[model samples]
Target: MAQETANSQENSNDLGTITVEAEALSIVTEGTESYRAPLTSTATRLDLTPRETPQSVSAVTQAQIEDFNLDTINDALESTPGVTVERVETDRTYYSSRGFEISNLQVDGLRLPMPYNNVHGDIDTAVYDRIEVVRGATGLMSGSGNPAATVNFIRKRPTDSPQASVSGTLGSWDRRRLELDVSGPLDDEGRVRGRLVAAGLDTDSYLDRLHRERGVLYGVLEADLTDSTQLALGHTWQNNNTDSNMWGALPLYDSAGSPTNYDRSTSPAPDWSYWDGETHRSFVELTQRLSDNWSIKGTVTHLDMLSDTKLFYIGTVPDASTGRIPNSFYLSKFDRHLEQWVADIHAKGNIEAFGRTHQLVLGSDWSQSRVQQSSLYAAATEDLPPLDEWDGSYPEPEFGDPDFVHDVTFKERSLYSAGKLDLANRWTAVVGARLSWLDHVGEQYGSSQDTTLDNELTPYAGLIYDVTDQASLYASYTEIFNPQTATDRNGDFLDPIEGTSYEVGIKADVFDGGADAALALFRTEQNNVAQLVGNIGGRDVYEGADGITSEGVDVTLAGELTPGWQASVGYTYLEIEDAEGEATNTYIPRNMVRATTSYRPASLDALKVGARVRWQDDIERERDFDDSKTRQEAYALVDLMASYDINENLTASLNLNNVTDEKYLTSLKWDQGFYGAPRHVMANLTWRY
Candidate 1:
């Protein structure tokens, strides 16, 4: 997992009979020096290029990351098509794709459910070689849940030769960042290799009194026990501390159900409010070559995350005449810790039957996670000072004993298998199924409850037909099941929610095979979805929905457009409806486009310039308090960058974001909302060897 093992580095646009004697090492795109990668294993268990895979897949390569300065996961996802990053608060976020939440994330094919808050603070990209997103039901590889999308983060590995680089950046709002990366052979025989990556950032925000500090580190070592066997160990750590963290966003409506006009920098946090987070992960992997056509890889990983927060909350619309809002105000302090362990083992190989070769993959995985938390709360001593008069100059609450405690554990195990067979001339079939067992047991808020489910099966099927040497037509169907904690009217747990996805499309190797293009029509159907039935014993009961649907169209093009030029562009149109045929999740935009392009002229080979544009249609969220919807109009943002090689080893670049200074709310998912970032600029310099 930390060294390259293959026949050799293959060109990105080349396509032919695909074989994988190099699966032991996986695919590495570190030094490819291209905006596009040639191979990926995230869409399917087999090693195939984006075009060869029967799904809508997208990749952000190392070159694109560096050139675009996408230093954080949020920054990268914002550039991906058919995806949405909702910043509901200062430190918490939610990601949605194809009208559903992305519930899990993977690293090198190892899966972990999303953290308690989905995402917090920052996830540095320095440790990753590339990030791949498989849009649609990836149940064939990922066990269950979320028919939206699957994200795979490929970690960087040691290089066959010594390499070193250092970089520094200064940006708007007193932002400063430094990063380092180095990799090399650890022994004279080149049988051992190592890589190290680290980054540090300190920054203030466009919001008043908000500040953040972050640090990250990643390390990996690989050793070859035998010529055909290898072992690798790796660990990663990151810490984030924020001052004046906003627990909740600003109020959107006033006493008269009219919108409130607050400056973009307006904040709801007190002077002493804070949020801090830490994450630690360690992994070990072993790969063995059973034969020239067969190989096995086993992996074990542990993840731990901690968050300590003390914050404030405000609710209800303010009164217009009294100068004092009748809203409820409160303060609370809580600390949470979560831990997870995951293990996976798999074997893949090729076989000959009927004078043709076919690929088969078999694997099993198990995972367990537990979360513990304690909280302290106090209602505001009095109504919060008038909204317009408040300046965060208020008395601190004298907190009492623990208000609540939570301890819960969840476990899931599954066995999955898939095969790619040559059905006939210019035809191929991909089919697979997974059987999973899941359970949740523990005391949550002092309530002891246990739930379990077994023998849940998910199936996957797909077919591809070669329309021409440069084009292919394909269709696929996939299913995923999500276990439920919700109870029925009889106090019995309901069955798992089921999601089935269908897609048909055409993919082509265009621009003389230097690029790839695809157009897909996709639809998803969900049943047994939870819905509010009625209140029983002063508690709301839920019943399954008959059916819910989401359908959309997607078009994308990516790769080298010409000599010294690269581009990636995507567009999407989506609609979601419930059993009654009424629109659902209206907050999700129906139309979106993400495009970026860079050019390095032949006359000025040492200089590069690029631009990016992101646009989305109008979206709205219903406000029960106002009896209306808080609507945000369509908006578009543009960014530009340029870099110049000062010498053989030094390079300088500058990036300007939100060139139009578009002003809009970050989200309206909740009754409260906040504004997005304003215009900003970042300058960076690097030295490499």
Candidate 2:
């Protein structure tokens, strides 16, 4: 029996496919830039191959992650097509897709809530094996969110055989990094297994007086209770510390509405300013097999985050001659504790019905999350030192004890079910629905308010037809619901935003699944979208827009283009409009294209080289009440990378990003322009045993 089990494991590993519960726990994907992902449960809650599902899905494989040096989630998302990354501040970044913000994130198919205004999205990639992205609404899996996209992270697991590796990196701007990973069997018969990963980063930014330190640790253990049952437990911890972080961007325009030119290294933060954030997560999963064709799995997770900062808030357009600007100095601290419990059980099998064989899945899930948050701030608005030359030197001001600000709480409970069936001929069908209940409360020093939403159901449906052996056409419709925290003019919580999305696409696997291509057209309609109306009684009042619509076309081709070359290319065109037929969400580009390709020559044998390019069209922004408008011209950035294998165990790589050093602004909001990174060069060395 042991020998048979060992053979089964070896076969599964070689194919990168899971054959049993144990095999699912420790399978690694191979290939540097492959577009073919065999299995993903993020879209349907059932482990179906990517092409078999009627939705658009993309997997950023482990080989691609390492080849691109995607050290953080931000880096990975920036490289992904049909997605836009906006850097709000030094430590905060936001991602959007299809003209809407992406607010849903999952780990191992478990949905987790992340705050947009906090540091939760700045996750490190050391603990993850792959990132799966599903474009369009994933309402059946994610309880409440916009119809943008869902990103699922798959964590690394212990391997059947012992494996160890170490890596070091040196980069521009005083950047240094080190990482270690080890995984193997922990006991006889390989019933128990363990894995550990640790990494540290110390980097100085291109901006003046800005430096950062980051640390990450992840550990996991898996045990086989029986031949058909398994259990796994894991935890991840990450912390980030920064010195001299800016609260906002440099001045966009002077008092005369003329654009200001400042050095790329210019920053408004003083030397004494700092920000720190920490996150910890723990999770458990279990899998049981009842029959040869039937199996079930369950997972639970807990997450906590804390943050603190002292900043010199820069405000007001500066004088072009004197360079004097208004400054507000303050110290703030925030503590957010979230406890989430989720339970799910499902059975899958093939049954003969009506003279045909069909795959059926029946499952139900229940989840509840509670968040408790509080914050305090100490401020001094008067007697600030300024009206001088632009420099990184400033005197620290005395601050008293922080005052009580507010206390807030939020909760969500959801139940969902989904299924997939093979219809007659080459046609397939998928259907699912979810019911959710949400509640929230906020107490501001002495005032409090409560809001609730009960029993809302979101539905999903899709149809697919296999046109040929290598091509399939599909169409899907999905819905989404998201509650808003913004208040109306009456001081009452605004109604939840409701969205419906329609998508039609064709996917093809070429070269015996060595490459994949997809073309999709989508339209999304959103109602009750909250928009800031004005300030009433010193409080902001928001009103819902009548409707917003986003229509777009996306084309992607990835995997091996030829025998010795791999490439991924994507293009996107989007149009968004409000109820009045006026353009909306103009910050996001209307036309964008990205391409990445790598080549390993048959002659060199040990040398590999690659190049990447990203281009976006011009974007225009118009204020709600003003006639003045701002426009960011179109631009393209280029990158290059090369690697040389010294031996079977040693490898060296070099990467140069922003080769042209383009000075275009990546984000322009409220008259402030955030410049993109100028240029970066990173070199890495790795050894394996």
Top-scoring candidate (lDDT): 1
**Candidate 2 residue-wise lDDT, 504-619, digit = tens:** 99988876677888899999888998889999989889998867789999898777877768777789899988888989889899998877778889899688888878899998
Question: All models: lDDT?
Answer: 0.82, 0.74
Among these predictions, the greatest TM-score belongs to 1
lDDT of 1 by residue, 132-153 (tens): 8888888777777778888888
Note the clash tally of each candidate.
Answer: 0, 0
Q: Candidate 1, TM-score vs. the true structure?
A: 0.95
What lDDT, from 0 to 1, does candidate 1 have?
0.82
